[model samples]
Target: MARSDIRRSAPSPRGGKSSKEQPRGWRLFFRRLFVWGFSLALIGVLSLAVAVGLAAQSLPSYASLKASQNEQMIVVRARDGTQIVSLGPSYGKWLPTAQIPQVMKDAILSTEDRRYYSHIGIDPVGVARSFYVRYQQGKFRQGGSTITQQLARTVFLNNSRTFGRKVREAVLALALEWKFSKDQILELYLNKVYFGGGAYGIDSASRKFFGHPGSSLSLPEAAIIAGLVKAPSHYAPTADADAAVGRAQVVLGLMVENGKVSADQARGVDLKGIKFAQEGGQNSVRYFTDWALPQLDLLLGENTKPIEVWTTLDLKLQNSAASAIKNNVPAGTQGALVSMDRDGAVLAMIGGTDYVTSNYNRAVNAVRQPGSAWKLFVYLAALEAGYTPATEVVDEPVTIQGWSPHNSGGGFAGKIDVRTAFAYSKNTVAAQLGNEVGFSSVASMARRFGITTPISTVPSMVLGSNEVRVIDMTRAFAAVSARGKSIEPYGISKVTTTDGEVLYTHEARSSVQLVPENVANGITDLLQSAVSIGTGQAAQIGRPVAGKTGTTTSNKDGWFLGFSSGITTGVWMGRDDSRPVAGLQGGHAPARAFAAYMKVAVSGRPVERFQTDMVAPAFQISPDDEASFSGSPDEYYYVDENGNLVEPPADKTAARRPSDAPEDPAPGPDDANRGGLEAVDPPPAASEDFLNKATGKEKSDGTPPN
Candidate 1:
């Protein structure tokens, strides 16, 4: 049984050859196998040929990937369409061979490619020498990449540290040599290489680090630039001056030893006082640019391809603003200034004290309590609610819905005219007005004026408990200064391509009417008083000006927002962590900065006054009063000379206060210094109709009013 099973499993054959002895079938099978093998090999070869052809066709674009590279950068212009800064695409600017100094050429040749003219892309001798040196060091140390190989790495090859990437770089370099002449390759290489300090290419580096173009580079500067090829950031003149100079000397010596430069030339070069542009006055503006760039992108779209944007930045104004902030603000304090034209174009913006240390724009990014600066919106709401600029408001402490707001001082002023309250920044008057005009309606009015911050109907909101950004606040108030027209603030004006083709244009959009002309005029008048005699007195600019001053709790934030006939500016000073700044107030730093900036921003420009009708707003008054309820002292009519309530023919003879209510006390002092008087909750006053109906009706006991 075992033998039969073994025989059955051992072997099987179709023909009588025991499966291994069929010579003719085996021969035919071998022939067919040979033909199939030949066909498969041929197909593989053809497929490889097609792939190579396709790669060759695409190789021209990346051929000189290592030769030279240049990146195009867009630039931005200040107001008047003057360039303020440039944005780099690849940190490169193309320069011809003739435009580069011989010293620079010799220095680079000695350091990078000694036999570049003779090599066929790969320098085998150099590679072998580098390999030998590396082997001796027992580690991967030296790189033997030719200038073309560098170009390939910088342009076509990824920066992965792998043998595959090196092989690909070599292949790309060979293709580059096949497609371009040596001089063209050199030209491109010089134009594309990075030399550090935000500079790309020899032309930009030559100017940035050496303060000269490539053609004007001295021997020392040329050597320094050539040496930077090893480590651009480390050897950058701006970063490590001593190290860079030492490295530059090494490059000079190498050039001499390589016969690229004479020893005399090396000895004659001096690198002393070789300062970088970033180490000089140009650094002053970097902070401002860093903060402004992202904002431009956000407003103009991410693909603002042109590196240059035409902004309304006035350098003189910016300088003045910065100087004023530095001088007036505390040592650790941060500040921002935003100035706009009447059309709402942001003429200048200074976002922080140091852009390099911080890109956070305290002006546009930080939202803090607006404090008394918010009274402008409050007054606007009152005016829209039929209260005149001259309306009478009791400046005494009064509580509503369990909230009590005090003026700056703890004492309460009794009665005051609206204009005087606003001019003096009396908190009680504004809070009372907020109560009189429904809080929700006032909030709606603020929203219409473009106050983007979410506002709650709490009583404290009348005092700017809501947080607001300087830019948004300025824009909102600028609408008031612009005669009731609300418009968005923008920095960029237009963007264009290098060929002068306009890629985008930012037109000032249509403005919304936030308040009526008369209401705006009244508020503008109050703001003028603020600059003339109120907390914003420091902002007076020797011309008719209008402005408001704001100081938040604990002096944590201070602001002075103002406008002239032509330009409006908002200044803010505070700490980043929302801590208190000692003795800081709107009248101190922010006002001073605003004034300083305006002096320069409006220099040589006409001095214009804000336009107003000079007419007082009409106010709603008691029916028994012959005089209107204007806040003027003469207009208040409690004792109408006859010991009777002034009225528009009301039946007041028989009327009396409820027996349970407390007596209405006479108004007291109007000075802002006496602000807090322990605000007491009072019963809701009757509506005008309800009061008219109850007037002259005595209680059943016929007692005098409580």
Candidate 2:
């Protein structure tokens, strides 16, 4: 067949064109392929658009994001509004983009996103380069997150490095870009980003790292802070100044490359002139703030607004107390002081000398034996048991159950009245009286006086063997100063919101009458004697003061608890590990500290004297008062004639009259009988003693006939 006929038979190769038009068949075939490919590409684009729109629906609304910007800071102040400390996730005032320094903005843009102004939430070219570089490195080495993307991640999304989280972050970034201006996005990012050391914003980071506001930051300072966006803690100037300086240099180099700063300008910057904020020792009231923070939450539940806590702490007194401890306390040993008013308002407290070294609140938390300070309760129990200040008790060595308590100086003072024994801190007399009144009675008496610590019923308890906190002891002593009304120590007087809404006001009132007025007056008289002429003589403040000195066994704890009509102060000095401080004693360092603190604490206060009634109560024995006189025979007795038993008159006044029995000779020094039991007035004469004398059955020795 002819060639033209063959081509025409093959559908004419392009509708009957010549062989020169054969190339058009191939073009037509390619054109149809391009049409199908274009349709598939459009369908794929539509599918991606649908998926992105669905994911964007799950993002937080713009209003919710705006509402979350109110981060409240808790500001704690003393009673006088002196700033003690401020605490929160972010601890400074928020700043707008206009308030931020231009240097900081330039540094951030150069180091983080150079195309921040030109991009719409994302830079495709930067992202592609970042991905290519990451793929070449075989690991995630760089991030392409723009500033807007970072703000979205910070304010709305979790910091998860996954494909899904990145996708969500990108979608949220676009949403933020659509809803807010670039300046608004930048402000949110600057305020919400975390800049280590518990600082969460540019303002906090600036003040924390530079000791100034963000508006005053210099070029290098801004560069250093901008470098922290990559790693805040690792590059924090407070922790490692060298690393932070290096990071700032890197940021400076980037700024130069991005044309934000010239190379000459960068070279003129001095990183050394940038003084990092001095770390530590800034807040002098951390101990007080630490204690008051928990109470803030307790008083105002779930507070979302800024709160102003008006604590009872006196900044002057607190500073003085801390200084007193720092200067007076030994180097190796630790000390704590708590000062409260008659109403149990804790005015000044120093839990430790340095809060930066340790935060343990020894004043509120340490429990140490009160030693002889506990004898106040014992003597109070004795007073309640019908024993008067003139009641005579032997101060010789005495044993109760298996425990024999000796004096601090290991020698008996012989026979002395209860007042003298207490003033001199006679351990033997205290133990004997504790035994006569019962140990449980003394413990109950302590509880009545607001000693909430656990009190054991052992005989040594009268010598302050039981452990107690300084705050508890201060409260108990304050009750005594308050004329026997119970008291509870408090630090926070009121808590209010920044808007003047009152949340709590302390209304402290006595829970119960801890001690009778008569008992309180009597105890006050004895304690006054303690401060005036006894072991607590060092605690005298020229005004009337009542206090007790306590030295624990082995000098493990030394305490001086005292109070005037105006204030109650307690001082404790000891090692934290319970190791005895060499040469430390209650009357030495602790009493000195107490006197030092009170000298300043009560300088301007009106001096008032304690009520003193020296007249002793008339003693009369009642047969129904068995518990008061339930001691053993060797513990009490009546005068005998020729070693024969005889009962005396019931009236104690008559029994005090001259005894008919021959007076014994003066006791010799070597005689163990020097401190022997003394005869006391007895009840009306009974037939049992008369019968013994009538039968001429004389007792051989002082021992009772069995």
Candidate 3:
């Protein structure tokens, strides 16, 4: 009975075999099938191992991978060690794994690799899921890479979504897992991932997005940063904060699902408090940084290591300058301001009101007509030609080589002293002075005073017809405040490596003397009068100041170049397209900006007077005589070195007098106080004859007559 039951329960094998034997044969067939399948699976595994090894042979060596870790950032800092900007491929501070906030670590793991701790460099389940997703989508839509794999790819591989790269990435990821801990791999990933806005690594991304450090990141902020690893440009908080926060919400949900945070905690995250980085003040200093960056390359050639640049910029002053320009200047109009010490150490500079909108540095790159400000060199030339502040020159309209220059304010004062002409910015007098001194002499004088712009020998050059940069004009005026010393303006004070090795140091050097002390003093006295009582009155800052105001003919450019005993600053207001700024004049916006900036710039400094003593004329005039001569008739009056009226030598021809001829109609307000006239016909020979007759000798034009 037991044998029959066994035979009934047993399976059949072959045609001639019993039921029991058939069950044995069926078992044998199943076993053979299992062995063949197992053998094929083993061969496939061996083949995959061979393929991985072959891919690994073509990959970069471990030494190169280690060497790639040496990439550093360039940090531009102000004099006070405050960071201004960071520049380089890896533009961020390297943070250690311990320094990274735990929330940030969790956020990264949750979003990038949920099984990061449990997996050995790769996750089979994630790869299979990703493959299914890609197959359904008909494209490679997801990267099934672990954190270790990402670190390997970022350190030694390009970001190409290809099968070969994936193989190499997997091989290298295994190598990284063998060599480093999970924390080590995570730290490398955090320090090397790109977070958009040109930032690389967690520290830079933290500072860029939140204006803080990685160690201080909140959960939401960490989630936001972790979200950026998926697509940096698309999730950049600065460009699209909503997109960034939305992605961060996804990360937060993942974090909660992974048991890293509670659902209540995830819901409690507030993105409102996260202040996205702005391109305003953080980038306002970029104007100065841009100017100073090239100089660093010049100072330290071909340097690959990270360098710290210590600039002369006072961030406070820089901020003030930018604010003043933004608040004071008209919207469509652009402005530039540069401030420097008497020794040419640039203290503050703003190339444009908004650096992000336009990076063109007007202070250092723009070359526009300075108008009456160019008269400084003209007057300087006259002083060098033995003309003192008390010397008299006719202010009537004058023409040279077809360039007829008219005085600002239209009507002439009949005749005036050189000091009065300069103070009032009388264009005719400046042109006549240019003629008397010869245009070449004025051009040479400008070159000597640190104007690097090309100057033409045209007579209108005396009225600032020649274009110039604000920095050049500021440097020129600095020489005046420095008592005629030549100045070379510079921004960077020192440069050093992050490791504290000195790369470059700008030595504080004495300036070269360009103008005679007496001549400089005389010029300073004239310009000081301009600020105190003339067109530059708007630039007055309660304390003594010396500067000039200039407006181009069509109001295309306006300028205020002034200086105290300690600092010299120049301001320019104009349009980028060279179009006229409506109602813009040097005495208006430019002067106002200059005054506002100087008031803040000199707040803490003691009020110091200019060197008036050095400006004492070679000859002195009696107080009573100077007073009595103020209301004298409109006749040509000759003065000697002592500023006393003197008769011409009897042996020379008698001085000619201006006839009672009717004067030309007065100029309109638009014509008066403008930059000046353009090229016109040469003045009548009779005018020179009159001068020759008055001096009782041939006219001295500062050149040998042909």
Question: TM-scores across all candidates?
Answer: 0.77, 0.77, 0.77
Q: Using lDDT, rank the candidates from best to worst.
A: 3, 2, 1
* Top TM-score model: 2
Tens-place lDDT digits, model 1, residues 1-706: 9999999887556554453544578788998899999999999778755654554467745334433234546676777765556667434345687887888888888999998999978899989988898889976666888998887787767679899888777776776777678887787778777778777778878777766666677787888899998998899887888878989988988898888878887788778766665534433355456655666555556563435667767777767777877777777889888888888777777778766677677777788898999888788877755566566565666577898888887876655667778888898778777776656545555655555556666778888888887887888778888887765666667767654777667876655445556678888889998889888999987887899999999999999998985788888999989999898899888898888878777777787766656444333234234234223212211212111122212433223335554533322333111211111211233234322222323322454445
Tens digit of per-residue lDDT, candidate 3, span 1-706: 9999999888666675744433467788998889998999999788766765565565565445433544556787887888777677544667788899999999999999999989988889889988999999987677788888888788778899788988878887876666667776787788778888878788889888888887788898999999999999899987789999999999999999999999999888897678876644555688788877887667888877767889988889888888778777876999999999866788898899887788899988988999999999888877755677877676665667787777666788756787888899998888877777667656656765666666676567788888888988898898788887667778898889876899899976544445557778889999999999889999988999999999998899999999875889999999989998888899889999999989988888889887654443322233234223211111212222211223433432233223442222222444322221221111122245445422334334544334
Best by lDDT: 3
Indicate the residue-level lDDT of 671 in model 2: 27
Candidate achieving higher lDDT, 1 or 2 = 2
Q: Whose lDDT is higher: candidate 1's or candidate 3's?
A: 3
- How many pairs collide in each candidate, listed in order? 38, 0, 9
List candidate 1 stretches off by more than 4 Å: 1-56, 60-74, 80-92, 273-291, 295-306, 498-500, 614-706
What is candidate 2's local distance difference test score? 0.75
Write down the worst ten-residue block by lDDT for model 2.
637-646
lDDT of each: 0.71, 0.75, 0.76
Candidate 2: tens digits of C-alpha lDDT, residues 626-683: 3343231112322121111234245534434255643223223432211112323322
Candidate 2 regions off by >4 Å? 1-73, 135-139, 218-220, 256-268, 279-287, 304-308, 330-332, 352-358, 386-392, 496-502, 576-581, 613-706
Please give the lDDT score at residue 579 for candidate 3: 94
